[model samples]
Target: MAKIPATIVTGFLGAGKTTLIRHMLSNAKGRRIALIINEFGDLGVDGDLLKGCGDATCTDDDIMELSNGCICCTVAEDFVPTMEKLLARDLPPDHIVIETSGLALPQPLVRAFNWPGLSTRVTVDGVVTVVDGKAVSEGRFAVDVAAVDRQRRADENLDHETPLSELFDDQIACADMIVVNKSDLMESEEADHLAAVLKADARRGVQVIRTAMGALPVEILLGQKIGAEADLGARHEVHHHHHHDDDGDHTHEDEHDHDHHHDHDDFESFVVTMGEIADPTAFAERVADTIRQHDILRLKGFAAVTGKPLRLTLQAVGPRIETYFDKPHAGPRETRLVVIGQAGLDRAAISAALTA
Candidate 1:
């Protein structure tokens, strides 16, 4: 029996993982591909979006979703059984693509392939880590270690490690390849600098590609045949040893920590629905203002623009927002935006601002 190859798509929130996977599924080019979408929130928004692709290669049964928690955290309970079922089917998939939640760690998820049930049956083709170029260029995840160290010393209750920063670093370090997405939102120099930072985090010799809206050639995105499962030991992870409490008391240990746990509750997401906006440019500016005001990590959805043939899709990573006409909607057009941020975001205020 030929072993099926799997590709793990990992990235921070709003980094365009779903879009990239959708593009791949749309242009599968006769390959019978299966997709597993792991969402952090209750709504299967990403999975639903992909299902509407209407691609022959992506049937309803070909797409599976694992919600309620991160895949790495629920590997034994969720991932294993799902993979077993997929492999047991008489018509097994030629290739499998997994779009992990933005907060997930690819290293541990890739390590799950070592399980007895899947070790010989499936191999990880590659680990593609998508990065938000504009966000990185703005130092969203690039915290000053020296400054943080000093702050931690001043306040015993302050945790030295930021979950968002560590999450970004972990994804960067474990990638077999990195995609610096949303490059169009930044200047050429800014994109180049972000790429350099991501490349430094990535494994040596790993390729870094720049794309906007996750547009990359299918051939470049797939068929790497890296077998990341075999090279897991070579990938470096930064959050290996230290585990700190939310209220400070950090520990910097050197133990090879494998039991990684994810706290999804640290992040919060809320949806806003509104009628058509007369001015897309103004509305997008308002949305970006609201995100910056509330310190939102990600905000994405579609809006119905008056006189526009196609629905305007809005995506924001940090304060940088990008809008484009994705496709024509079959039904009535309205604005529906999902805002994700650290806990304690003023949802009511955010909604009011966007609608105002």
Candidate 2:
């Protein structure tokens, strides 16, 4: 009974996890792969984006979605059943990949592979953590990168970790490989510095690679054969006791008074659909203005441009926006983008700006 190899992809919001997964699927090279996506919002934007990749391996049946809650918190009710179904398939996939929500902790999810029913059927090949290079360079997760670096160097035990920093650290500390995504957004030196910082935070001998648009060789991602399920202790050092029990009633928030769900309430997401834009540049300018006005963290989706046969892809990480023609629209040409940011975002005003 050869066990199916599974890879866990975890990272913060807007870290390019889906991009990497899509790339892997498109270049699977004859390997039948199944994906499990755990989305933070009910919109299922990530799952929808992957499905539009137009790859045979990315069929709706193969790509499962668990949107009710994070897999780490609902492993018993959500993850177990999903894995069971995939494994029980008459023609089971050659590999499985689990993409966790930005706010998820990978350690807990990886531990779920140790369950009695799944332990023998599937093995955790590796935990790949995708980090936003630009975000790290800009100190998005930390209050002060230099000061934190100094404090960490000065006294390893006398460090104060913010909730965001804690989550970032836990993800990095548990990664078998750290991918500094969006490297092209930063300078060579900037990417190098972030990579160095991540290398130090990760477990000893963990590989750190920089990639643009989550591009990397498929061989580098799969076939690691690390058996992460058994090596969790050595790889996942931080937040060891944060995982909940099999009873399924308790959550990470309950264990640490963390309130991840309530904390995430600080962020809000809304979709805006409009007629085709005549000018992609002008529309992007308007989107940038709205983001600046409301401090929007991420905005992405596809837009239909006037007279263009292909759909225009739209993505914004803070004020930096990236646009390109992805593929032809399947149906009516319309500009649909989802705006995500901190709570109290002026949805009406932002919608007005897009329409204006």
Candidate 3:
């Protein structure tokens, strides 16, 4: 039997990983695609969004959510079983797409494909890393290579590495293709320069594509045939060192360290649910204000508007907030949004402000 090709979509928080995946699913063109969505928050907002996408190729049964933890850390407990069930299906999907949590390290998850049973059944088609073009232009993740090198030279003992940068580097290093999304927010020259810098730093032959609203043809996103798992050695990880046990399974030295990088101690997330929103526009403004006040990284959820029949979808990344009525209200009418940020968020204050 031919191995099923799987694409791993990875990016930092609000980098448009879910948007890209939803676009791909919408344009599947009769292809049977299954989605395995991994989220960092308490609520499965991404999964819920994709499920409600109304794509024929992606139904409720076709989508699976591993919200217990980051996919990389829970591979054995969550991912493996999920893959097993999919492989066991009589009518398996034509392609499998795994959306990694924004904070996840793709190296660990990619390496998991080489495990005993999975290796023979599913091959990694490619690893796609989505970069927020606007965020990069604004120095959000601070991926500037030249600046970092200069800072390192200035101070021998200066460890300028933050958890965000390390996570971003790991995702970029493992990718076969990098998608610079939200290009509409960037100027032509600015986007070009960012792409040039990313291409120069990435492995040879890796392509960087710029897009707006996560819009990209399904052809360009899939069919890489890279089989990335076999070339794991070339995909360097910035935050982890691997060691193999006698059983030939790989383990990480960082897992034993006191400050394990994958533990996500540097970040936190919580969901705030409230009654119906009287004014969608005003509510979005309030959410944006609260995010800025609390330094929240990403916030997204559905809201039931006072008079509107459709459920309002709001997503805030940084200070930019996007809100639209996606579909009709399905369940109880309420407003719920997941707030994510660096550790030590003022949750009580944030929740009160959003609900107010």
* Cα lDDT over the full model 3: 0.74
lDDT of 1 by residue, 16-118 (tens): 6777777687778899999988764335777777899899998999999886465655778899999999999999999999987655578778888999999
Task: TM-score each candidate.
Answer: 0.62, 0.62, 0.62
Every candidate's CA RMSD: 17.0, 16.4, 17.4
Per-candidate local distance difference test: 0.72, 0.74, 0.74
Worst lDDT 10-window in candidate 2: 247-256
Q: For model 3, name the residue pairs that clash.
A: none
**What is candidate 2's lDDT per residue for 1-356, written digit by digit as tens?**
99999999887656777777877888888899999987653347777778887888889999998866656667788889999999999999999999886666787788899998999999998899988788788988532345334433343222233345666888888888888877777888888788888878777656677777676656667766668889877755454323341111111110111112111233468899998999999999998898777667568889999899999998875566889998999989998999875457888998998889
State the TM-score for model 1: 0.62
Give stretches of model 1 more than 4 Å off.
141-161, 240-356
Q: Over all chains combined, what TM-score does candidate 3 have?
A: 0.62
lDDT of 3 by residue, 1-356 (tens): 99998999977655777777877888897889999977543357777778988879989989997766555556789899999899999999999999876556688788899988899999998899988788777877533444333433343322334345665777788988888877767888998899889988898767677777676667557767788999998997866522320000111101101211122344578999999978777888888789767767568789999888999998765556778889998899998898876567898999899988
Order by TM-score, highest first: 3, 2, 1
